[model samples]
Target: MFINFIWLNVFLMLCAWLWVSYNKRAGLVDVIWAFGIALNVILASLIFETAPLMVRVFLAVASGIWFLRLAWHLLRRYCHETEEDTRYANMRRAMGKYQHLGFLAFFLFQAGLIVLFSYPMLALLNIPMEQWGSSTIIYLVVAAIIMLVAFWGESLADEQLYRFKQNPENKAKTMDQGLWRYSRHPNYFFEWLHWFAYPIIGLAAGVYSLWIYPILMFLFLYYVTGIPFSEQQALQHRGDNYKDYQRRTSIFIPWQPKE
Candidate 1:
C-alpha cells in the first residue's frame, strides 16, 4: 500500500508538472503539496486498522483541516497572481535551456517530501488501540494546544502580510507590525512548530522516530527554503530597510524586537 501511495504521488506530480510547464505557474507546487499530504494522511488513517477508530478519526479531522486551509490559501493567492511567482521565475531563468527538466525534477522532489512527511502520520495511526493510557490524554492535550497555536500563528502571520501587501503604499516595504514585528518569518516559525505536535503525541505511543519531523522542518525553514530565500528576495527588493528589520527581529522565534 505504501509503495502504491508513492507511485500515485509520483504520477500525480508528473501531471502537475505538465500543467505548470504549460501555465508557467510554478507556485501550484505548494497547493498540490498541501492537498496531497492531507489526502495521504487522511487516507492512511482510514485504511490503517492498527489504531483505534476514535484516534484515526481525530487524526483525519485535524490533519484534513490544517492542510486544507493551507491549500486553499495557496490556491486563492495563485488565482490572483498576474505572473509566475518570483522564486520560480528566477529559478526558471537560471535554468535557461534546461528549465523544463529542472522543474520536472523539482516537482518530483516535492513528491518525495510528501512521502517522507507522511511517514510520521502513518506511524501515529498504527499505534495499537489497547496501548492507550493516562499519559496519552496528557500528550494529546499538549499536542492539541501546539496544533492550535501553530495554526493560528501561521494564519495570522499570512493574513497580516497579505493585508499589508494589499496597500499600494506598502510596495517594497517590509512588514514590521503584528506578528511580523517579533519574528522576521513568523509564518515559517509556526509551520515548524506544527510538526512538533506529532512528536508530542508520538511520545505517548513510543514512536520516538517522530521527533525527526520537527528537526527536519527547522532545518528546512531556517537554512534551506524558508528564511534564506525569503530574506534574500526581501533584501534585493527592499534593500537596507529589510536589513534593518532583520537586525531587530528574531529569525525564527517570536520575541521582543531589538531597539
Candidate 2:
C-alpha cells in the first residue's frame, strides 16, 4: 500500500512537471502538490480498512480540508499572476539550458517529500484499534483544535496578503497590516503550526516518527524554500521597506512588533 502510494504521488508530480514546463509557471507545482496529498489521504482511508474508522475519517477530513484549501488558494494566485514566481524564475535562470530537467528533479523531490510527510497518516492506519490508548480521544480533540487554529490563521494571512496585492497603490509597499504586522510570514507560521497537530495525533497511535513532519517543515520553511527565497524577493522588489518590515516583525512566530 505504501509503495503504491509513493508511486501515485510520483505520477501526479510527473504530470505537474509537464504542465509547469509547458506554462513556464513552476509556482503551480505547489497547488498540485497540495491536491496530490489530499487525494492520497482520501485514497488511503478507503484502502486501509483495518484501521480504526474514526481515525481514518478524521485524517481524511482534516487533511482534505487543510490541503484542498491551500491548493485552491494557490490556484487562484497562479491564475492571477501572469509571470512565473520570482523564486522559480531565478532557479530556471540559474539552470539555463537544463531548466526543464532541473524542474523534473525538483518536482520529483516534492513527491518524495509528500510521501515523507504522509508517514504519520500511514502509521496510524496500520495500527490496530485495540492498540490505541485511552488518551487517543484527548489527542484527537487537541489535534482538531490546533488544526482549526492553524487553518484559520493561514487562511486569514493569505487573504490579507491577497487583498493587499490587489491594491494598485500597494504594489511596491511591504504589507504590515493585520496578521502581517506581527509576523513577516504569518502564513508560514500557521503552516508550520499545523504540522504539530499531526505529531500529537501520532502520539495516540504510538507513532514516534510523526515528529519529523513538524521538524522537516520548520527546516524547509525557515531555511530552505520558504523564508530565504521570500525575503530575497521582497528585498529585491520593496528594498528598504521590506528590510524595515523584517526589523519590526518576527520572521515566523507571531509576537509583539519591535518598537
Candidate 3:
C-alpha cells in the first residue's frame, strides 16, 4: 500500500512538473498539492478496505472538505492574478537559469511531504475498531472539535485578508485587524492546528507515531515554507508597516497584540 502511495505521488510530481513547465506558473502546484493529498487519502482508504466504515467516511469527508476548500481558494486567487505568486517568483529569480529544475525539485519535495503527512490517515485506516477503548470516544470528540475550529478559523482569516487586500485604500498597509491582530499568520496557525486532529484521531486508534505528522507540520510552517518566506515578502512590500506589525503581533501563536 505504501509503495503504491509513493508511486502515486511520483506520478503527481511528474504531472506538476509538466504543467509548470508549460504554464510557467509554479504557484499552481499548491493547488495540485492539496488535491494530491486528498486523492491519496481517498485512495488509501479504498485500497485498505479494512478500517471501520465510519472512520473512513469521516476521514474522507473532513479531509475532502478541507482540501477542496483550499484548492478552490488558491485557484480563485491564481486566476485573478496576472503574475506568479511573489514567493514562487522570488524563487524563480533566485534559481535564475535553472528555475525549471529548481521548481521541479520543489514539486517533488511537496509530493514527498504530502505522503509523509498522510501517515496519520494511513495509520488510522489500518487500526481495527476492536482495538479502540472507551477513552477513544473522548479523543474523537476532541479531534472533531479541533478540526472544526481550525477549519473555520482558517477560512475566516483568509476571508478577512482577502477583503482587506481588495480594498484600494488598504494598499501598502498592514492588516492588523480581526485575526491578523493576534497573529501575523493566523491562517497558518489555524492550518497547523488542523493537523492536531489527525494525530489525536490516530492516538484514539492506538497509533501514537502518527503524532509526527503535526510536529512536522509545525516545523514546516514555523520554520520552512510558511512564516519565513511570508515575512520576507511582507518586509519587502510593506517595509516599516510590516516591521511594526511584526513587533506588535505574535508570529504564529494567536495572542493579544502588544501595545
Among the numbered candidates, top TM-score falls to 2
Q: List, residue by residue over 79-142, the lDDT tens digit for candidate 2.
A: 9998998879989999999999999999999999888777777777778877888888899899
TM-scores of all predicted structures: 0.95, 0.96, 0.93
Query: Better model by TM-score, 1 or 3?
Result: 1
User: Best lDDT goes to which candidate?
Assistant: 2
Q: How high is the CA lDDT of each candidate model? A: 0.88, 0.89, 0.85
Error of 2 at 156 (Å): 0.3
Q: Can you write out model 3's per-residue Cα lDDT over 87-180, one digit (the tens) per residue?
A: 8888999999998888888988988987877777877888876876667768777888998999999999999998898898999999999999
Prediction-by-prediction clash tally: 0, 0, 0
Would you list the rank order by lDDT, best first? 2, 1, 3
Worst 10 residues of 3 by lDDT: 128-137
Model 3 stretches with alpha carbons more than 4 Å out: none
